[model samples]
Target: MQRWLTYQKERFPLLAHFPLVLLTSWCVLSFASPEPVKIGTLLLVTLLILGLFFQLRVFDEFKDYEEDKTYRPYRAVPRGLITLRELRNVGLFVAGFQLTATYSWNYPSLTLLLVCWIYMVLMGKEFFNPEWLKKQPLLYMLSHLPIVALIQMYAASFVWDLDFPPATWVLALVSLSGGALLEYGRKIRPPEKEEHGVQTYSALWGIPRALMTWFLAGSFGVFALGFAGGGWWVLSVFYGLMFPYALISALRKSALWLKFVELFSAIWIVLMYLALARFP
Candidate 1:
């Protein structure tokens, strides 16, 4: 049990995931209500989202098992620290916990949960055509990212009592863009560090192009946040200056700089949600 707990903490890093999960739920819930949400509602959504993310991680482990064995055998699962059976059991437990929590909400909210739950299952299987999406990275990413929007919408549904409004699309788009930015950032590794069978964005699209796409996604995130009437200006200027510098540094092929850029992209998402919670 201790070993499994350690593995989960190392993979998910609660320091980062908890803040982002809590704020993400708060940000979306705030979109439905001008004032603060109830403590019970806020915590329930946070737990559901966190469990969903954990399942996503478990899905990745199963999906990438063979690939990880070939490209990065030292990883926890690839190195035999834990088996897929164990991980799948954990994933099922988390999903059950999420369902139990959602049962406390209204029936309409359960429908919203079902939407996300179904979407997540499809994502885990890569829509039943892994090879097809592996050949189309952008489409693959776009397909997978809507879950972020769906989960955000699910959070909003609880606040609005099943009468969630279309205005919440702004929050959805913000979540999508922020997710895309982080997705792009992590997959943008330098060429030398790139391992065979690892389909990094840097390898798929040249380093410069990948960096440009990441920055573009971040810009869209800024626009979405500002459009949602949240504190977006701080992020706009922050990313506007930060991205170009990160791009230039990435061009110089500094691995350290690229990693820092990844960290910064995560912080950008965290801060945006924090600001939304505090000011929205």
Candidate 2:
């Protein structure tokens, strides 16, 4: 048992936990507001989503095996801590099991599960195709937007059964811009001399240029969130909280953007919950 726990920790890492926490909380909050659903049903959805979530990590290890060896040797697959066969087996088992459990939920729940699966597959492709899409930076960012929107939509409407409120849109936009910040930060990786396979933003374009593009994209995110209609103070507080992170990012010291955005994203979610409580 101890060995299995350690393996999962190595395979998924702490960063993996953030997405699961955000997603699961979104689902549970859905159950909480407007009207509460049966605890049993909510529990089932949580378990299923969380299960698939972990399994997706396993698949990432399998897909990025070589890249991990060269660039991210600490990662589970390249480090030889876990085998490709084991990853595939575990991913399939978890996905099948999670879907089977979620099948008992309403049709919308099952559909949401299916949508999540398709997203996992597509995201894997996106990571591999980053270079191909870099020609159109805006299009590249636009392509990734739906993934965030889907998560927000599932949490806001499908699970919560709440109307698409201004607050939910704020959350979705925050999630998108937060993610873009990561893409922007990737532009800062020191340039490599030799030809490389890694299709990162920095790899395709030199760090300075990438950072400029990313900052512009982030500016758009801030503007969108700022203009989005909602409670003035709540929105102000949310955007204000993000500014420090952006400020730190502008200093161009290191990859602090992710740290800031992660903090910002978490705070954004909390603000959303507060808005939900006060407004609805």
Candidate 3:
């Protein structure tokens, strides 16, 4: 139990993820339907989103096992803090629970849920072309990032009829941009912190270029949120503040600021969704 707790702390901090997922699930449902979201339904959808995220984390653990063992031996699995078999069982259990719950709650959602699972499985296998994909970091990131949008679509299934009109898809676009922003934010490390085999945007594209990409992603997110009826002033201000901080941090090569950038990415997503929920 203690080991599992430590693993969750290191790999997936619940305190940070729960509210973000909850808000994400809520905003999707709220955006889909004008009616007030029921508490029970909101909680169920949040559970589903949380399970999907954890399942993906487990998939990453399995897929990256070798590289992690060789280049990142201090991680939970390589350090022997947890076994792959144990993580596999947990993943299976979560998958089963998600499948069962979705089937019981809304049979129509099951199809979309299965589709999301298929995409996730493909991601876990790196689309069976790990060599080619690894050589193309941009494509690799784009392929995996759509899962965030798919998860949002699945959440919308609870409130929407699944027709997924243009307006509905704009919400997915917001999610995709958020995923990109978070992906770039977390991977933009200082030069001193770059690992030999680890692939970071900073290492691949250099700091200035990586920061530009991150900024563009955040810009797209703001546009999508505005299109989806989100409040813009607050989001714009927050983005303006974070960009300079990111520049200063990258310039000084401050590891602490890089961590802040990651945390700010989460905050940005949460704020975007919150803005949608409020203005809707």
Candidate 4:
């Protein structure tokens, strides 16, 4: 039990993720329904989203086991803090809980959950061609990013009919862009910090280009929020304030600044969801 708690702190960090998951679930529920969200529904949806992210982390551990073992031995799974078998058992338990919870609380959403599971299974397998996909980093990231959108759609399903209007997909786009922003931001590193066998956007695309891609991904999310009739001005103001600093940091190749950028990516997503919840 102690080891599992340690593993979560080192790997998942529920303290960092819970609020974001709750806000994201609330945003989707707000956008999908005109009615006020019951506390029961909000709690169930937040747990479901949290469980989904935890399962994704578990899948990543399994998928990247060999790579992490070789290049990142300090990680929890690599350092013997937790065994893969134990993690797999926990993941299975979470999956079962997600299924049963959705079935009991919102049966219609079960289909959407299954769809997300199917896509996640494909992602875990790297679409069955890991070698080819690895060679195309952009494609690999793009392929996996849809999982974020699908998760958002599933959240929406809790409050919306399966046949929701086309406009609702804009929220999915916002979610996808948020995922992209985080993916690009976290993988960026100063040139000096690049590690062999570790795939970082900064290493692959150079610091400037990688920063540009991250910025553009974030800009896309802001535009998506505006198009969806959310309070995009809030994000736009935040973006205007942050970009120059991020650009200067990247140009200076400050590792500390890179960490700031990574942190900002998470904050940006939370704010984006908050803005969405403002939808009239």
Best by lDDT: 4
lDDT of 3 by residue, 168-188 (tens): 656777788889988987799
Query: Which sequence of candidate numbers ranks them by lDDT, best first?
Result: 4, 3, 1, 2
lDDT of 2 at 103: 54
- lDDT by residue (tens digit), candidate 1, 1-280: 8768777766777777887788788777776788768888888889888888888889889888888999889788988888899989988888788777778675577887888889988998999999988899999999989988888877887877677566666666778878897788779887667888888888888877887878777677667667667766576556667777666865686686676668778777776666555545
lDDT of 4 by residue, 175-211 (tens): 9989998898679887778888899998888888888
* Tens-digit lDDT track of model 2 for 29-136: 542456654566555555554565576666567666767788777665677666788778877888777666655444455665667678877777775675687567
What is the C-alpha local distance difference test score of each model? 0.78, 0.56, 0.85, 0.86
Q: What are the TM-scores, per candidate, against the unseen true structure? A: 0.91, 0.67, 0.94, 0.95
- Off-target runs (Cα >4 Å) in candidate 2 are 1-4, 14-28, 31-33, 36-42, 127-131, 134-141, 155-231, 252-261, 272-279
Candidate 3 TM-score, C-alpha based: 0.94
Residue pairs clashing, model 4: none
* lDDT: worst 10-residue window of model 3: 227-236
Worst 10 residues of 1 by lDDT: 271-280
Worst 10 residues of 2 by lDDT: 186-195
Candidate 1 residue spans exceeding 4 A from truth: 228-232, 278-280
Clashing pairs in 3: none
